[model samples]
Target chain A: MTIRSVAIIGLGLLGGSIGLAIREKLSEVTTTGFDADADVRGRATANGLVGAVCDTAAQAVASADLVILCVPVGAMGDAARGLAGCLKEGAIVSDVGSSKRSVVSALEEALPDAIVIPAHPVAGTERSGPDAGFATLFEGRWCILTPPKNADTDAVSALTLFWQELGATVELMDPDHHDLVLAVTSHIPHLIAYTIVGTASDLEDVTRGEVIKYSAGGFRDFTRIAASDPVMWRDVFLNNRDAVLEMLGRFTEDLTAMQRAIRDGDGDRLLEIFSRTRAIRQAILEQGQDVAKPDFGRGSKEV
Target chain B: MTIRSVAIIGLGLLGGSIGLAIREKLSEVTTTGFDADADVRGRATANGLVGAVCDTAAQAVASADLVILCVPVGAMGDAARGLAGCLKEGAIVSDVGSSKRSVVSALEEALPDAIVIPAHPVAGTERSGPDAGFATLFEGRWCILTPPKNADTDAVSALTLFWQELGATVELMDPDHHDLVLAVTSHIPHLIAYTIVGTASDLEDVTRGEVIKYSAGGFRDFTRIAASDPVMWRDVFLNNRDAVLEMLGRFTEDLTAMQRAIRDGDGDRLLEIFSRTRAIRQAILEQGQDVAKPDFGRGSKEV
Candidate 1:
């Protein structure tokens, strides 16, 4: 594979950003993105995120060495099926879906004759659209690849280098393991956020207004997470239902215990749990995942 | 009564910040603060957050024209009764407790002859202690005041002026209304945060480790919320039980609906509700309650 051309399907935040990242990393690579929405393709080209806006998925991947699928998780199988025939004989196919097991399995069955590699670039924001994409979006973020056991080593190496060149540190894991890790890290957290923010949205009109007014205290954080792309998240929860619900059950049980502690005025138990959680925040800071200061160094010189 | 001297009891984050705000805004006021922890009193005086440090609540309240109780909600009653006799004649007392109804009721019943008003500064951070105090902490924030029905008008005016001078936009409301408002905004949010973090804290060791590693996506937000002053939040949920439970019931019901929608693959319904919440984020931005950027404008400007 000469690897001179790349096709990115879905010119939303992830795909558009990948287009920019790849272009920045490999100047010789001619990137073409095809979005189902013409406006997205138009915007991606206008923003210089893609060198060319392919007229169709087949047109984009017609002569590319790598074809990327960055759509909603639920749409992966259909997209894989659509591109199965158009993809070059030995070209590598990958996705940036949050989940892995089901997506990989579906892509495998949908494109039995094509080599599909499932990779998740663990970076993003609540914002979507081509305008929200940026080249350095993947800096210092992890990108996990879950390739089938029988997949070609050369194809995997090529895919790894492609993501690594975009400023992501690549890691390989079993598809099932990737799903489990994400369920714990990303999916469950988002579910809880959506649930809490939804809870506030249902309050009596007066209280709902107050919740919005004073959200910066804590609830606002949940609202930001809850505000993530709903179609994408809904598909994630539905596809990863068993895992999300399982983790949610654990969460609710723990919540119920805390509720009881509050009711019983068990300050010791509350403080103990708070102390443990604070240590986790410290660990996140140590790992460079979060800032040590409350303002996260952004408001270092605030008004 | 000439307002020459003021007493700030409990000298922690809220008390120290109040001392700083008062001293910075009121040049004529000579402020003294006392804390159960000797080190807090020493630090407050040494750091110049207060004009003086006293060994006892009685010592601090004696001869002061006004007294402000900035302790945990659970201790408001004790602080109220303890200073009743020691407070100078005609001295006005107020608090910065989060739960207005409980604190007001407690203070009214415990110190019938003393002037008491309950207030909440709708601002703070996860960090506590005297060193965390800042004069700007209350700036651009709302200080919700809950004065009793038969409260002295002059006393209310003086306190309102005090907060306004500290750069807060003070609003007056009934104590019950204040409680209801906070139940939706502060108390309910903290309860959810504590519950979610407790959930993550109890996960299997391997999964728990990964949760910390990848927390930046969303869980990190909840962790910061959950890491709030534990004692303060425990008292909030317990004292405002009726309102919090009511709001919690509404929230649980809403969450059930969201879960059902996701389980059934109802993308439109999820999108509608999630989209609605995005407007709330926008409102927070417009109102200057929260910034519009992710990671709260942390991370690199380009990334």
Candidate 2:
């Protein structure tokens, strides 16, 4: 069945962007959105992020064929439980959480009767909140859907089509695999960034002011990733602790190996690894996942 | 003396950009440049990276009042030694190496009779070589000079003026302090980026294709940094081993703490660190070291 009416449970960056994308691209789809914060709800409504801003999650999902919970991963179970008795039978339920295994388990347990498909759109800016979203945020981005093994094929296809219509390339994977994959590509990178930025700030010899002034040397890039929504990332790390710790373990081992190479003055080994990593960047660019411009296109633009 | 002739050795990104910037900004200064690679020398000549591309390092340094060595940190001694007898008496000599302590010592030992002053322009893109340069590459960026205590004040001022003319802000730092600051800002960041990208590539559960496709989730930024010139980075890690290792130790401690928080479900600690790092990003932006636009302004530009 086609998704004609949609309800978004959280009007933050991901949720607000979904609402805006739907309104801008699928004009026929009726959008209903709600947020825990009153100010966020007001901003989302005034910005035309949704056609209707409901006061309650139950009111938002009552008439909708699709309900997407866009809250933090830690809050997924509670948000799902709040939708009890409101979701229409056969209506598809989904979420935009960074981690899939825990979220899928929480959602499936909370809504046993609904068709739950956990998905994550691998796209975002460092900004957060209702006003930090845009219509084209999903354009050229990937959305991975982790549906249960016994999920209805038609429901999965419909959810895939819904994301496709909003400008996302869709993929299907098991929930465990999704968590593992995202842990490597997203979670570990963020953890390293946060750790390094904090490390730089806490240095006594290198003043914080000096670090900020000379950040363009390379530290600024890490700052951007570390500046991502704190609560959401904290939830991600907590929810996906197993996968995150596993990947971080591998990262620490590799980092220690590199550290030993540097300490031993192994230029050949350092060059080998550095050269190998350069090809991956080229692959990312060739795959159309990133821009080829130098400095991530930061130097060409005006402030 | 008001410098009129400038010689550039190495003719790569930093050297070529210096030539281009001199030609664009200081029209009266005669530029001579030389690179070890014949193809790079020919390209620098054709691209007008310098007024004259010399056939040998000796020729490049023979007639210039100011000579700057733009080679990898490990190669600075060899490059400086190559100009031993060719440099005119009383001519100023400097270098653009990421690590200051080793480079200053190398140049001072190799060209003991010349005015050896080491400087590092804290500006670059991922790409390297002669073609990866522009006249405005150093605009508004910091160029740090670490001159010896016994160095002539007029020579230091002249070097500072030369970089300022090319649109760089000049700062005077001791060699050890410069190396320590850059160890936090540039060297360690590049090392972590390379390590994480390599770690992601070596994953057994996730396919390389999958990692590349979902890279926008945060991995893409690290790839850009890891894509930087491998040889230069190798030399940096070798020359700045002490400081980089020191900072990496602190980073490991911080990351271990973060890992513990994640494992123990300490949301408060994660949130506190994340929130603190966000303010550093803001401070970097306020200092004009980074753009305020989200995602390094990658979303607004076309590939």
Best DockQ goes to which candidate?
2
Give native contacts recovered, as a fraction, per prediction. 0.54, 0.77
lDDT of 2 at B124: 91
Question: What is the C-alpha lDDT profile of model 2 across A198-265, one tens digit per residue?
Answer: 99999899999889878888889999999999989999999889999999999999999999999899
How does model 2 score on DockQ? 0.72
| Predicted structure with the largest TM-score when compared to the true one | 2
Per-residue alpha-carbon lDDT of candidate 2 for residues B167-244, written as tens digits (9 for 90 to 100): 989999999999899999998999999999999999889999999999999999999999999999999999998999
Q: Using Cα atoms with residue i matched to residue i, what is each candidate's TM-score against the true structure?
A: 0.93, 0.98
> Judged by DockQ cut-offs, is candidate 1 incorrect, acceptable, medium or high?
medium
Please give, for residues B1-303, the per-residue lDDT of candidate 1 as tens digits: 456788998888888888887777787889988888888878888888788898989999998878888889999888887886788888988888988878888888888898887788888877788887777777777888888888888888888888888887888888777777777777777787777777776767336777776676677777777777777776777788777777777776776787687678777887777667776766776776766564554443463
